[model samples]
Target: MTEPQAYLNGAVIPFSEAKLAVTDLGIVYGAAVTEMVRTFAHRLFMLEEHLDRLFDALEYVCIEPPLAKSELKQICERLVEQNAALLPPEQDLGLTVFITAGHNLPYLGLSELETCRTPTVCVHTFPLAFELW
Candidate 1:
C-alpha cells in the first residue's frame, strides 16, 4: 500500500519523506506555532476558524509564512482528500498544521541565512484513533 501524504512548503509528497532541517529554529529553540483540526465525516471541521488562530499566532511571533491563508487552506483540503481514502468509512482524521521560525541563522551563517528567510510550513494528518478514547 502507498504511504499517506503530507504538505511541506509548496509540495505535497509522501508523508514519510516530509523532513525538516536539523538547524531549523523549531528544533533548536522550539520556535514554532502549531494547530490541530480534526475531520467529521471526511470533511474538515472549522478549518477557517482554525486558520485564523494559526495565522494570528504566526503574526504574534512575527513569523511570515511562505503561503497566504487561502493557499494554505487549499493545501490542507487537498492533503485531506488524498489521505482520507486510505481509511475506513467510519474513521476520521486529525489534521496538524505547523509553521517554524525558519532556519537557525547563527548555525547556518549569514550567507546561507539569506536564502532561508521563509518559515517552514507543514500539514500532516493521522487517523483519529477513536478506539483509544
Candidate 2:
C-alpha cells in the first residue's frame, strides 16, 4: 500500500504513521483547539495577527505550547515548502493549529487506568476552499 504523501510529528514526513491513543482525551472527550490562517503570494499575510489569535486560543483552553513563536513559524513555513509542488500558481495556502488534550482513559473499561495529555502540533498546507472576499 502507498503511504500518505505527508505527515508530521514535530518534523516532516512522507508516510502515514501517526500515533494516537484510543483513549486519548482528544479522542474520548473530543477536546480540541485550533486556529486557521490563509496565505497569499506564497506568504502568510497576517502571521502576527494569526499567531496572536492562536495564543489567545491557547490561553483560553489552558494549553501551553512547548515551542517559541519562531520555532512554530519555521514549522509552518516548512509545511508550505513541502506542499508547494501540489499547489497552483494562483492558489493560496492555508495553515491550521490543532491541539488536543492528550487522552482520557476514564472509560477504557478499566478502573486502574489513568490518561495523560499528549499534545500534537501540525503545520500543514491546504488550498483555500472557503473564502469570502
Candidate 3:
C-alpha cells in the first residue's frame, strides 16, 4: 500500500514525516484546536461547517491560522483528492486540520512570559473504518 500524504505548514509530505517538536505548545500545553471532516462518495461532507467550528475554536483559544478560510478549504480538497487513490471504493477519508500555538518558549526556558507564536498548521487524512461503527 502507498503511504498517505499530509500537509504540514506549507508543504505536502508523507504522513510519516509530519512530525511536531516535543516542545511544541500543542504537545506540552495542549494549546491547539482541531476539526475532522469525513468524505462521502469521495467528496467532503460539511467542509465549511467543520472549518467554521475550527475557526471558532481558534478564536476561543486566541490562535490565528496563517491561511484564510478559502485557502484552507482549497488545501483540504487538494489533499483529499491526492489521497483518494489509496481509498477503497467502499471507504472514505477522515480529513483533519490541526492548528497549534507554535513553539513553547517557556518549555525551552527561553522566556519567563508566554506569548502566542506563529501557529503550526497541519492537514492530514486517514481511511475511515465503518466496521467500527
Best by lDDT: 1
Q: Rate the local accuracy (lDDT) of all candidates.
A: 0.91, 0.64, 0.89
Which candidate wins on TM-score? 1
Stretches of candidate 3 exceeding 4 Å from the true structure: 108-116
Q: Residue 21, candidate 3: how far off, in angstroms?
A: 0.6
Residues 1-133, candidate 3, lDDT per residue (tens digit)?
Answer: 3888999989999999999988788998899998999999879999999999999889998888888999999999999988988877778999999999988876766463343367889999999888999
Winner by TM-score between candidate 3 and candidate 1? 1
Candidate 1 total steric clashes: 0
1-133: candidate 2 lDDT, tens digit per residue: 1222333446666534555567666677777677777888777777777777877787788876656778777777766665655767788777776667654656554452433544556555677765564
Q: In candidate 3, list every pair of residues with a backbone clash.
A: none
| Model 3 lDDT, residue 47, Cα | 99
Please provide TM-scores, in order, for all candidate models, with all chains considered together. Answer: 0.96, 0.73, 0.90
lDDT of 1 by residue, 1-133 (tens): 3688999877888999999999998899999999999999989999999999999999999998788899999989988888999998889999999999988888888898664687999999999988799
Error of 1 at 34 (Å): 0.2
CA displacement after TM-score superposition, residue 66 of candidate 2 (Å): 2.2
Better of 1 and 2 by lDDT: 1
Ranking by lDDT: 1, 3, 2
After TM-score superposition, the amount by which residue 72's alpha carbon in candidate 3 deviates from its true location, in angstroms, is 0.7
